[model samples]
Target: MKKRVEHGLERFIFSSRWLMAPFYVGLIGALVLLLVKFVQELLHIAPNILSLKDSEVILAVLTLVDLSLAGNL
Candidate 1:
């Protein structure tokens, strides 16, 4: 009886791994989307950099950094 319970518990724990598969896939997707946004933002800001104030450039970089950190989390 004890061995049977152990085997059942082991199986249950093993199967639980599948529950996190979707979460990992979602994170990957989020990272990809964030990357695309970062690139787009860079392209949009590149030509305007000379005219942009220091604060404007800082805000744009910070936005990109925030998105990347969120995707990592």
Candidate 2:
């Protein structure tokens, strides 16, 4: 009986891997987009950091962080 239960559990885990495959692929794509956006933000800031108001800079930074978190999820 114990052996049967173990065998069932093993099969269940193997099948579940297929369900998670898409999730892994989506996470990788999101991570790549996040990296691209991060670089874009840096470029935008480099020219205006001194001229832009502090609040504007803060807002852009917050947006970058939000994108990173969403990608991680």
Candidate 3:
């Protein structure tokens, strides 16, 4: 009887994985937001890339690095 109860409890706990589905969905949304921000940064930098001085380029690269270092990094 004790062994049966233990197995039932294990099954019950395993079935609870669905409880985390929404959290995973939220993470997906967060990733989408990050992707959009990176695209916006790219658009903002595209036009000035050629004319940017060394210091300006460094700043832009740092911005990209910062974005990449988010939890996804």
lDDT of each: 0.91, 0.87, 0.88
Cα displacement (angstroms), candidate 2, residue 29, comes to 0.5
- Residue pairs with backbone atoms closer than 3 Å in model 2 (clashes): none
**Model 2 lDDT per residue over 7-73, tens place:** 9999999988899889988888878888898889889888988888999989988888887787767
lDDT of 3: 0.88
lDDT tens digits, residues 1-73, model 3? 9999999999999999999999999988888888888889989999999999999999998887788778374
Global local distance difference test of model 1:
0.91
lDDT of 2 at 38: 85
Q: Which residue pairs of candidate 1 clash?
A: none
lDDT of 1 at 70: 78
Better of 2 and 3 by TM-score: 3
**Alpha-carbon RMSD, each predicted model:** 1.5, 2.1, 1.4
lDDT of 2 at 15: 89
> Which window of 10 residues has the lowest lDDT sum in candidate 1?
64-73
Cα RMSD (Å) between model 2 and the true structure? 2.1
lDDT at 14, model 1: 98
What TM-score would you give candidate 3 relative to the actual structure? 0.87
What are the runs in model 3 whose C-alpha is more than 4 Å off? 71-73
